[model samples]
Target: MLKFIKGNLESIDGVAVYPIISLLIFFIFFAALFWWVFTAKKDHIKEVSNIPLELSENETNDKNDLPL
Candidate 1:
């Protein structure tokens, strides 16, 4: 199966460039993500991290307020 796929890919012109482009895109995406994470504000990070806890608390409060 691997040989069959590689054989077909070998026939395509400029196939080498595709791998290079894909690698560059992958690297750039992670690089940008790392940059954003490093530059993000502490307040914003804390708020975002607490989103799940806040949601659960709100749901609990809502349930308590409902007619039993």
Candidate 2:
């Protein structure tokens, strides 16, 4: 595996630098996303989380129409 990687690295121009730069960009993107998710309004997360559990008008109507 090491020999294969070395052969490919030698054949490709700036391949090593590309991986480093790609990893840096990925790290920055995830860091920003994590910060935003953890620090942004808590209420927004609460509202979104509750959506699946809250019954909609159509769902309530369906329940009401069910025979006892």
Candidate 3:
């Protein structure tokens, strides 16, 4: 199976460029992600991290106010 696939790929023109292009794309995406993670504002990060807790608190408050 591997021999068959390799034989097919070897016949195609510019096939070698595909691997390099894919690698560059993968590298750039992670590089951008790393940069964003490092440069993101701490206050914004804290607010986003608290979103689930805020939602749960709101839900509890809403339930308590509901007519029993």
Best by lDDT: 3
Return whichever of 2 and 3 wins on TM-score.
3
Could you estimate the TM-score for every candidate?
0.80, 0.78, 0.84
Model 3, span 1-68: residue lDDT tens: 99999999999999999999999999999999999999999999999999876657778899999998
Global CA lDDT of candidate 3, please?
A: 0.95
The list of candidate 2 runs beyond 4 A from truth reads none
Residue 21 alpha-carbon offset, candidate 3, angstroms: 0.5
**Could you tell me the lDDT of residue 48 within candidate 1?**
92
The residue pairs found clashing in candidate 1 are: none
Q: Rank the candidates by TM-score, best first.
A: 3, 1, 2
lDDT of 1 by residue, 1-68 (tens): 99999999999999999999999999999999999999999999999999877757778899999996
Clashes of 1: 0
